[model samples]
Target: MKYECARVLRGHDGPVFAVRFNEKGTYCMSCGSDRTIRLWNPHREGTDGPTSALMIKTYKGLHGYEIRDVAIENDNSKFVSCGRDKAVFQWDVASGKTIRKFEGHVSSVNAVTYNDDCSVLATASYDSTVRLWDVRARNSFVPIQTLDDFTDSVTSVLVTDHEIVASCVDGFVRTYDLRAGLLTEDNLHHPVTSLAMTSDLNCIVASTTKGHIRLFESKSGVELNAY
Candidate 1:
């Protein structure tokens, strides 16, 4: 498949760290060094490009530092974002207001993702940990679980129906099986920067800081290929 730039989003004053489309692909959420989270209609083009008008909403006044990652819920009713402020924020999309703030990580958060049903949120942080928070719990500031096996910063995280996958600067990609209560660690021997699963869920693709992308069999931890 080939892709082309249909529209250029140009609202953020600083580098945008992450941009994610809602499940339906009707909208998108972006966060970055500007310390703001913006909702955009990427499908719309405004002559030169989508202007500030295409920016549906701007969430501000909460994160005191640069926003690193943003995750939109499956239904697009809410979203989650993590940043240098060391806090994870859950926002109501329509109101553009923060609904909850989950704090525990002692350092910058690098990635954030929602579970299959939006019941939970997982965050990777520079503190070398991945945390799982119960999204529907009220008045709760503690994470439901914390995985801290990394020797270096956890750079990325992804949560699926049955497992939580994370990549770290320690040169490993870890998968936690929620149902089996087991952990699988695949040592790539390179500082892993990001991770994604195959659409069939049978394999994982990991990218490293050394500029290599590796594919692995999801269940067996076998390296399939590298590019």
Candidate 2:
């Protein structure tokens, strides 16, 4: 495999906190301390220039504070963003308008993501809680469920078909099985900052502040390896 610099997205004014490619990798959504979200077409054609990566759209004014993270839905029609404002803004990709604002977190929201079908949104926050919101529910702004089992800030969250996984500053990675109603906890003994799952959905990869990356079996919470 070969990798090279494709194009540089130079619109954001400050540090970009998160950048996520859509499921198809044709485009991406990014947000940061600039309190703005920009959509980019990284593979745009024609002669390369300083701004070769075409900035398709810029979504702004909805977030009152620095945006911490953003996640795109599977269809790429909409995306969600969370940040220091303590609210999640669900935006329409084409119109660049906020469709809904899901607010409840008392502190900064560190991460936000959608479930497999984009029916549910899971958010991790400095409030030491992970909240789940039902996107299909039109009239509700409150979370359908809130999981506050962490003693410290919850930094990352991801949802699978049957499980919602969250990692916290408390040094634990917790997985909640939605169908089986079971909870599994894996103590890493370090403040976990990020979480990712394998494409096969069978393993979890967690990164901690101590620079440790640990892999665990999804079902059994067994540590497979560490780096």
Q: How close is candidate 1 to the true structure, as a TM-score?
A: 0.94
Q: Candidate 2 vs. truth: CA RMSD?
A: 2.0
Worst 10 residues of 1 by lDDT: 45-54
lDDT of 1 by residue, 1-227 (tens): 89865667778999999888888888888888999988888877644533432677899989999999999888788888899989898889888888899999999999999888889889999999999998988777899999998999999998889999999999999899989999999999989998888888999999998899999999999988999
- lDDT of model 2 at residue 19? 89
Off by over 4 Å in 2: 1-3, 45-52
TM-score of each: 0.94, 0.93
Report the poorest 10 consecutive residues by lDDT, candidate 2: 45-54
* True lDDT of residue 93, candidate 1: 85
Per-candidate Cα lDDT values, in order, are: 0.89, 0.91
lDDT of 1: 0.89
Model 1 bad stretches (over 4 Å): 1-3, 50-53
